[model samples]
Target: MKIGIIIPARNALPYLKEMLNSVQAQTRPAHAYIAEDRSTDDTHEWLRDHPDLYAGMRRNRRRLGWAGSLNAAAALALADGCDALFTASADDRLHPECIARCAAVLGADGGRDFVVPYAQQFGEAEHVQASLPDAGLDDLVRWPPLIDKALIRREVWEQVGGYSAKATPPGTFGTAEDWDWWIRVWKAGFTRYSVVETPLYFVRVHPGQLSDARAEHHAATVDLLAKLHPDLPWTAESRQWPPQHRTTRRQG
Candidate 1:
């Protein structure tokens, strides 16, 4: 399968190079695309300077936010005839076998629609996170068992219509977008998924990141999700973190 990595970046200059370097170091040869979302830093210039780093790059006129930027970049990959798409954040790094392992599992299993890899949080915070071995619709609705870093089949993405661009408060963005997408994926009937035991994805945790805003808008985001899917039993308690899934401290 021709796997394509879509990296949505916004003011990610500090860790962008490291992330790209990890992409280049992948054991499997996968095409990489960058969606530069009107970054104030020199991200655009840097991407221009290193043409060999990625197969293609798209710079948005305005900030398209996380989901919007991902959709734009995924379009480029799909147009280029990529069979699979993996969305990676500009600040994160992938293990050398990340692509290879995911591609192997998908290629070997005809029934699997997507593959989720265990992830570790680094930088300012350190913890290892993994989804349930057999996560289903309820697991997704309750809490996002899988992160957005998973490798997804191109057809599944096309069928689900890509990630939702709508933010909770209309004009704002980047709150529970991945979680929303996962719920849509489940609702669309593409429920066959697998998990990679190894921590192949590394998410950087720091102050003043998008996650901080996601936490702030948790209540509103839950309300918006409830409105979006009234059929599902979304409660005020769902707004609070679930105890079922917990992160463990990363071992040295």
Candidate 2:
């Protein structure tokens, strides 16, 4: 299966070179795309000069937010006829075998819709938990299982109607889009697995990281999402997952 890699970029100038270099160093390098989200920094200028890193590069006329940029990249990857799309952040790095291993697992079992590789957190904000308010106590307790660097089949992505780009008041529209999408995927009968043997992703946590900067906004959005999808089990025992429990699958 052909895998397409998409990097949703904003003011990622600091991490862009390292991120692109890692992709190029992949054991089985896949087609790469950058959805530049009107970065205030030199992100767009650098991307324009480095044509080799990305097969297709497009800049948003205005900032599309994280979810919007990812949606754009996913669309481009799908249109390019990729069997699956792999998503990474400009601030993170993927191991050389990440894409290859995810593809192998997905290809081996047609029943598996997506593969989420283990990620090791690094940088200034490593392992830092978000501050949660007492009002959203339940949402705070159970952080959704995050597939930091995930490879998802096109069919699964399409089935969920892509990430929600709508900006809800109190929280940005795309806030918690990844968690929301995963919940929808499970609700739609698709299965996702985590690769625990090897931590194939490196997530950099810095001062400007979106999650850290807008923790409250994200929490509010997640609370709203849980309300909308009550069956998601956001507070269930499966919250501490991956090696914490067996891979989730629908009962026969």
Each model's Cα RMSD: 3.0, 7.2
Off by over 4 Å in 1: 167-171, 208-215, 241-252
Worst 10 residues of 1 by lDDT: 243-252
lDDT of residue 249 for candidate 2: 15
Candidate 1 residues 1-252, lDDT tens each?
788999998899999999889988999999888899999899999998998999889899898898899998899899989999998999999999999998888777565898988888987676677766676766655567776788999999999999887644465757568878988998999888898889999989876552454544666677788888788887666776322344342221
Q: List pairs with backbone clashes in candidate 1.
A: none
Give the local distance difference test score of model 1: 0.81
TM-score of 2: 0.80
CA shift at 110, candidate 1, in angstroms?
2.6
Query: In candidate 2, which residue pairs clash?
Result: 166-173, 167-173
Most lDDT-accurate candidate: 1
Q: Which stretches of candidate 2 lie over 4 Å from their true place?
A: 125-141, 167-174, 192-194, 208-215, 230-252
Model 2 has a clash total of 2
